[model samples]
Target: MLSKSHLKALSFIREFIVHEGYAPTLSEIALGIGIRSKGVVHRYVQALAQEGVIELHAGRKRGITLPEPNKERDMTLPLAGRIAAGRPIEAIEDQVRVDLAAFFIGPGRFALQVCGDSMEEAGILDGDMVVVAQQEHAADGDIVVALIDNEEATLKYLRRNPQGDISLIPANSAMVPMVYAAERVRIQGVVVGQLRTYGKR
Candidate 1:
């Protein structure tokens, strides 16, 4: 965890680097955070460096640089290479994981390739990989991949019934929603983000 001032300084430094293409001077950072003291800003920067959240390049001016976050477990996901139709594919061991944090949040994330146009209206097209956050439950209207009766699975909007049933609603108006017993429906995961590729002309 970082202190409030430390976080503020990090934010300022990130925004400054993004817009200015370089790190800010301690004096500028002090002004950015309203500290009015370059010395205080230096100490904060030093603390951030000591915490391994940043680095201070020796013998260089405006050398403060943000370090990569020390999180590694969710940095990658198991890639099936090219697959997944109506069933969840088995994980391949000895496989290199492609960094997909760019697609979604949380550590329990996985990728699934779309095989149908049922979710096309929801902007999910065939061949797109949906990054899902692993969870057992989702709110109503959330697009989720639901395994019905521990066998057949479908991706659609989720809803409930007064009689304690689950409704799997598809985005395509040409398709009708399927209702099933709540006990038979298992939420595999909720859709968080998606990845798609375009062909070059």
Candidate 2:
């Protein structure tokens, strides 16, 4: 079990890594938590390191290494969205950042913002940011983001019939089901968690 002070430090460190995409330095951690000295923060971080929660890579710039969320008490993870797979993953630029590493239980994760009413009945309306785990395959009835016809990308429920035909299921009855030969559809990510901003509708 971790002491209260250790837990507080861990929470602050986790927040920094989530929002900043990098671990905070001792000074930054100290200041963020209302402490005055980097030395104090270093001591707490050392204790966390000793507990095997985080690893410090001394002599390397930006040397903090955090274990996967599976190794920690926080089960959520940030579901990252489609990145230019050809380019590097960019920094998060949302107005308010969420630490979703605890929510993403998958081994891989990413996030995307919702943009349509097709899934509105599921309460995933426009402007909701959903965290999706990157996955190449899923079982029937999994909600997934898929690229269809190379021109349209949609969020839908994947249904695989016994005959092996695949259909994209929409929650609302008004929208017709889209059926395709299983070979043409590409799975992007599986929905793991949903986050709605306070004011964004």
Candidate 3:
């Protein structure tokens, strides 16, 4: 657990890095936090560094850097929810850590898990992990898990037919194509990585 002051400092540091693209100097941090003494900021920084929350670069214009955001096994963190296949699941406070590391192949990454056989043809199945790069849009032919009508999420190969109609293709031919307006689909993420369980039966 982190002290309230330390957490506040971390929040301030993250905001500064995001907006200013550099860690503020001790004096600047002190001013930002409305503290009178530079030593107080320095001590807080040192404490945060020791706690593995942030790092300081030696003799640089912007010395402070945020550690890569990683999930910790704790009860206070955000809980995950079920992926909607027919209708989007209502966002609720009940999910646990879904191991989002695989999705974050690089910066600005996120992840979600697969839930059904609607996409089995694509090798995505129930219990398989789906890593996705966070984005607002996807190119045609990309296998994406998308939100339809703001009610459900489903996985399919995205395509634009010759007639300029949008379709979600299931790799399994037995499964029919899902057609919808181009603007009706909301791409949550593109499937970039998958995890499978194996056992010789």
Cα lDDT, all candidates: 0.75, 0.70, 0.68
lDDT of 1 at 36: 83
lDDT of 2 by residue, 4-23 (tens): 67778888888888899998
Whole-model lDDT, model 3: 0.68
Looking at candidate 1, what is the lDDT of residue 183? 94
User: Which of candidates 2 and 3 is the stronger one according to lDDT?
Assistant: 2
List of clashing residue pairs for candidate 3: 79-95, 80-95, 80-96, 84-153, 87-151, 87-152, 88-151, 88-152
Which parts of model 3 are misplaced by more than 4 Å?
Answer: 1-80, 84-94, 100-105, 199-201
Q: What local lDDT does model 2 show for residue 107?
A: 57
Tens digit of lDDT per residue, candidate 3, span 7-62? 77778888888898777788778778778898888889988876667888888856
* Candidate that would win on TM-score: 1
My TM-score estimates for the predictions, one after another, are 0.63, 0.52, 0.53
Which RMSD does model 2 reach against the true structure? 12.5
- lDDT tens digits, residues 1-201, model 1? 356788789889889988999889988998898988888898999877765667899878889887666643445676433323333333232354556643253468777767777778898887888777779999999999787777565678899988999988878887778888899989978988888889841
